[model samples]
Target: MTDQDTLDAPRDGTKEARLVAALTGKGQTLKQLSALLTWQPHTVRAAMTRLRKRGYVIDRVAKTEKSAARFKLRGDRA
Candidate 1:
């Protein structure tokens, strides 16, 4: 698909898609993504791995020990 087509494609209702949507324009912590998706932290991490396998770039922002790291989609639209 064209780059724009890839960018504009609708989410297919998968957990990974939902994660991508959530991270489209903003970063969110693992806890926030888990809460938003009603998924466990490990599940969120697995979905992120799948997204990476599918060639989506994800950025992680490290925070303090007491805070969860933040994640966001990088260099692409939702």
Candidate 2:
């Protein structure tokens, strides 16, 4: 999993793979994703950055203050 071929999907790597998988298919919020992934928000952000770079477009939609964030996916290619 070099930097170049890092897709947002679970794409064959063990590290951060589950997090990316949960995010891509489940549309979990940042907080929820953090909890589910057992990762901090910053870790989530870092993983998300790598995911986005690999053609995974994630939109951080602001929802209610109390509710968790609404994660949205963008782009034609995964």
Candidate 3:
């Protein structure tokens, strides 16, 4: 299947699923994820931690001083 098709595969309709889908593409900042999920920044961070525990390698991409840090999924154990 196409990458977009893979990413768009049926999910369980959970916020976490949406979070992973977002991260599967270009890096996203905490604020962006928060706005996308309608969650607080801390909540998004916590979710990232949970994903880590679940074997997703999320990398923090440093940005210019004027920009917030961005995060992306490096890979998944699965």
The candidate with the higher lDDT, 1 or 2, is 1
Candidate 1 lowest-lDDT run of ten: 1-10
TM-score for model 3? Answer: 0.77
What C-alpha lDDT, on a 0 to 100 scale, does residue 19 get in candidate 1?
Answer: 81
Give the per-residue lDDT digits (tens) of candidate 1, residues 18-74. Answer: 887887776799899999999999999998887776667788978887877889878
Strongest candidate by TM-score: 3
Instruction: Tell me the lDDT of model 3 at 10.
Output: 31
Tell me each candidate's RMSD, in Å, in order. Answer: 3.9, 5.3, 5.9
Scored by CA lDDT, what does every candidate get? 0.76, 0.65, 0.79
Task: Please give the TM-score that candidate 1 achieves against the real structure.
Answer: 0.74
lDDT per residue (tens digit) for residues 2-61 in model 3: 233334333578999899888876778999999999999999999998877666778898
- Segments in model 1 whose C-alpha atoms lie over 4 Å from true places: 1-11, 64-67, 76-78
TM-score of every candidate: 0.74, 0.63, 0.77
9-42 per-residue lDDT for model 2 (tens digits): 5546555676655655446788887888778889
Q: Give the local distance difference test score of model 3.
A: 0.79
Ranking by lDDT: 3, 1, 2
The lDDT leader among the candidates is 3
